[model samples]
Target: MSIKPENINLNKIFIKYLNEKQYSKLQLHYEKLGKTEKQLPAIIFYYACAITLNPSSNIKNLKHAHNLFEMLYVNNRHDLQLLCNMIELSFRTQEFKVVLPYVEEAYKINQSDERLLLGLSKIHLYLANLKESIKYYKILFKINPKSKINRDEFLTSLNYASGITQEYYLSECKNYLKLLETNKDLEDYNFNFKNLKNNKIKIGFLSSDFKTHPVSFFLKGLLLNFNKDKFEISLISNLHKSHYDNITDELKLLTKNWININSLSDSEATNLLRSFELDILIDLCGFFRGNRFQVISNRAAKIQACWLGYNNTTGIKNMDYLIADHNLIKKEEEKLYSEKVLFLPKIWNAMTPSNILPEIQKNNSIFTYASFNNFHKISDDTIDVWSKILNNSNSQIILKNPMPSSIVGEELKLNLLKKFIARGVEKKKILFINRKKDFQDHLGLYNNVDVALDTFPYPGVTTTFDAVLMGVPVLTMKGHNLNSRCGESININLQMQNFIAENKDDYFNKALSLQKEKNILQNFGKNLREKVLKSSLFDTKDFTKSFEKIIQKIISK
Candidate 1:
């Protein structure tokens, strides 16, 4: 039956009760509407809204909601509001696959809607559809050049693009920075140089990830081994405490000063940092989330450098240096970066090993290749290359799902599985593992892996170190950019250059060759820990000394 004029009143009351969070009233109003074909849209819309408001309330709890949606699907409701609400609910619940059809339908009705464009862009990016993300970001930029989300997302999309050249990426970064500079009142600072007579050199580090992050993992070694008499260290953290605050207490003891600047505005933060009068300020969170570029822009320290948190350039003109090693950044590549290169003498990062080691596998005839890198790094080109390797070898591949607990995470895993299956690889041959809660259990998974295959154009850094520390050899494909060469850098430090491939064909050949030589793999696996411990990769004391020397020389100059 069609909706009567009186039924429209019930719809309005239903919405009002839903907004007021009057579930009892909302149920009364919904019942008042009665079961009619025209009322189905309103029923479904209200049901979705109720579930969103209270997550414990499922759509199944209201039998009419499901039946209404199915009926509406068969016969067009043409209700944009209902579609929008459904999309909103799906997004809120992280049901991205459920949101796609609703988004597509909404987009058709209002192509020029900014919210629709932004939502579509974010959804594609979340789904790891890099090309589609870039497309929508470009459109959003064209429509609204001042959109900060579009600018940030565009840069992130560029980072994930494996085919993009360094020059092109640099150009985009410069243009983005130019826009930001023009929009803000960024004033340059001129600090009077004062040479300390006998006091320690005051150094400050800026980062939002001083807790259980990879940045903290690599940075703790330097902080722990610092020459306290020569340098006084301080930290400006943007986040108070994270679940991964394993080194929090240790860091506080090592640091002379620790400031939590998460609550401060950019201007306020810059002023606070300037008050510290830091001799050297190093930005660990370069272009990552919660980055205080304004503090560096205002010149909070005499010398400023970017390191660790991000792999590429920040494109900020005031930033003095981008710390790297000769391996990660070649002299020729320095021209593309916005900041001057500070080439560390040894490995740029020094990893602290876990005391608990997984028992190395000794009996497996079948060689199992694995990669624990994040899924975003596994681009289409990377998948194609990996498929070729799998096709060439009789070995099966294992991948770790970084966010295995979420719906989006599961979707990403399914997408990867589909891509592998399309490449003539058997579904049973591929395995997707979840991230382990305990760090020891996480490392223990390395026991199952024969060799770790590195993701191209954005290779593993911490994953590589962990694999080698666990006596698993990582095969990395070298690329022109810094993001791709991180694994290679670690390999070079561990003196495993033979595992690094120059190109795709070489990468495949290297894997196949390694699979054939089980004795070499076994020997490498047995002695890998000793090799890493002896190398500069874990030589924290030496790395700290060399790092301090570089800072001293920079200040002296």
Candidate 2:
């Protein structure tokens, strides 16, 4: 591992430029070295710095960087730092396919590098290699037991793996929670509520997605319909300043108190929340990004509960309850959650309808099945089942691409096409569509679909609402856990029990059965909008009253 004199001189210049933050000079230094002789290490270092400085560099620059790295790599320079830096750049640019080999090579060079191991784990997860992802994650955890980021990511990957038993999921989640609890001390706050004398109950909602998000879509109706005389609502928003939207404007008009806490530290946030003296603090985000679990873990309010953003348990001891309907969480599954289950009467979420309507289906000769869920949810099992449905009937499947603009997105699409082709499905039959920017256009795409197919182990929540609202029937297979049963809950609330499948055979049979009953489907599609409009799913006023009653009961106790 002795360094060459040329390499030593190049490293000295590189370190000097990096310390001085002279990125352009670093590139100039490489150009200078190139004139004298081809300095491979210097060239690779130059590209790495360029990519690091400008992550949004165009494809031409990225291709040049990749070429430089490959040239040195093939020549056996095998610099561990250079390999890791290139892998990180690829990840930053969302070029995940470019990262795999670099990570593998880095692992071979130094198996002890935590950064390389983490990147390898993430790369496998992105490629949908769940077992490999888990293996690398376990190795990383063993190497660094105190890394919060690694622990959280490991729990998330484990949660998404198909066919994981509920017992195993709960055990892993609990272990992760224990790690979090041990690493961070909980904050304590004392408050006096003795001054209460027939005043409105103060309710606070905390979330990062207070605008243009699934939580906002369901939450707006309830906010608009709240009985102002009985409740004073406060929105503790974690939304970044750039993400403000018209929906945020509407929310502001509905509530008098709107506090932006995105810039606040956990201690500062908790102090502000305690100042408001909120009777009930509702955590709309559970385990999702931008979650202030630190504040929640500190007991920011008299009563705190989790809902909407995540289906799984928060595993925080301070979180009092999990808001769900009986249909979503069965009585037998209560032990799986750390929080006490608070069952809503009918639907747990209230829907805010889109003004745009789906165009009516003209011809119903052949069936078109669709799913707009994220690409990660389409596991091997889901593909296998879906392929069977497509193979058995005169059907075509439409899947909305999760990230159509990225290289990783393109790779995922190709992988999916290969899977379908292996299962005897024509490439043309499986249509991968880019997501529309306009919300109305997104809804209209469902018009082209006959019956929407729900993903397994993790079902669609907002997408299901959007599909059915647009007169598209969704067929779902119920699962053993709360995450899997979201579709079933929606179907049950719509009073469409026949659309719920008990098993794989049942799911296929139900889909096949729908293909034959064109008249029934046509009629169902025709009347769906009206049916949903009348159901508890869309009855926000009544839903608000019921929700208010629950809040009042909790406060009284």
Candidate 3:
């Protein structure tokens, strides 16, 4: 190979340096080529990129990189490379708002640009503006119906929406299936079902959240206590390697077959799964992130079902059954889902009981309410009732979430605080807690909480259970659909009907009323942990039996 003058793209050389980890070489080249007007932009862009991409990048260097990108972005408004650098670096320093105007301007310049729309939609979602986020995703889908990423983001956004009726939601789901009909669906696949009453039934669970997540807690009891002799198990984990934790190790200890499909493509993974000869393949991710619905669309096993992780219908008809308990799904509402609703006997979920005491000993006199759910689930309607609860009671509410550390996390808290401020609650009346804690420490913090205030339209499932496990009863408003009614189902299983609120006013009223019965509530909390263990909600053995019976019946068919 001969080096030819004018044959090389300087930009390509810079990228090569980055890809090869030639940081010193890149810096040397930039210094040597310093004063050329044509090479300056490329040099600055790549230099800033290197800083941001470096693992040891600190706050000072990150800010300098952010500034360099901002300068380049100002000169080259239409340069997507520069714009992307600006977008990424700004978020690193928590100055995400700095790039908003540029992003929106770029979108206006080219509304059909997929990257711009993606960045915009993600920005809106992070800002707690789901409506705007959904709107952009819908636009992106309309532009490129064949793009799976676009469709995935669009459908995930729809998961947070509450359609006026179940029919309206089902129609939306049907339309998604209709769109995917054009893709290569494994329609020719057939299942060879044998009489599995004598042999062990092989069940493969697909999920990305088998690690430290809400899904893991809900899935714990089942995986740990399933009739392993009768039902052979395998786990397909779809999460990035960095996300694997102690919980992932725990899940692996339960099953002999652990498939790491994190690096496999959809087709590769599907082909590998088909070779497993699975009798029943249940998708735990549902429509949430890392769902293998596309693989399910191929019918990988004899019987396919979806449960846990997500509450509502996945809208993908390939999922033959949607697992639910009687309390979780009403008989009349079965028609709302595309899949047949498989009703469990008592509860659809059961978690491992914590060994540590559920409640931390709180000596504070101020009454406290808290929700350990994610911040995005807190809608305006949710804040409406919560704010009223704060205004009427002589107490403060503690809101905990998985936010970034130090000042960066504090900024997100302010955004949430402003929402409550608009609804007449002062900042001081609400306290924010960081979610970085040991599992035992996390459970103990529930003791300081007087009542766990569940969010509406999309109530907390695992968090609701977490509260009960910690001797704290969650106050949740009951609603019609599955997403809104999860708390209802969990509470019903525990026979805690008084904890359920019927409507908005009822929710606020119940919150205030519960505050008045502080002593009674605390005494009840002391025994609630014991009650939760005995109830069907935490009874792993009984729940697993019900689960196995359903799986056995399906395979036998």
Provide C-alpha RMSD values for all models, in order: 4.2, 3.3, 3.8
Per-residue lDDT of model 3, residues 409-485, tens digit only: 44466777998998999889988887755877777787688889998778888788778887788998877777778
Residue 486 accuracy (lDDT) in model 3: 84
> Using TM-score as the measure, what is the rank order of every candidate, best first?
3, 2, 1
TM-score per candidate: 0.86, 0.89, 0.90
Regions of model 1 farther than 4 Å from truth: 1-92, 108-110, 183-198, 240-244, 403-408
Deviating ranges (above 4 Å) for candidate 2: 1-17, 20-37, 40-47, 55-78, 105-113, 184-198, 363-365, 402-408
Rank the models by lDDT, top first: 2, 3, 1
Which is better, 1 or 3, measured by lDDT? 3
lDDT per residue (tens digit) for residues 1-557 in model 1: 87876657767877777878887656656566556544655565675456456535563543334344435654664555554555555444455676576666777887776667777887777677777777777777778776666565578668776688889888878777766565344343454544553277788999988776788889988898888988989988897565326567667777889998888877678767776777788999876667777667667777789888888887878789888898888887789899999989877879767766777664455789999888877887888888887877788888885444643456667767888889888887788888887888888888888889988788888888888887889999887877668888888877789999999889888988888774745587768877877889888899999899988888778
Query: Where is model 1 poorest over a 10-residue stretch in terms of lDDT?
Result: 61-70
Candidate 3 overall Cα lDDT vs. reference?
Answer: 0.78
Instruction: Judge candidate 2 against the unseen true structure and give its global Cα lDDT, from 0 to 1.
Output: 0.78
- Answer with 1 or 2, whichever has the higher lDDT: 2
List pairs with backbone clashes in candidate 1. 212-244
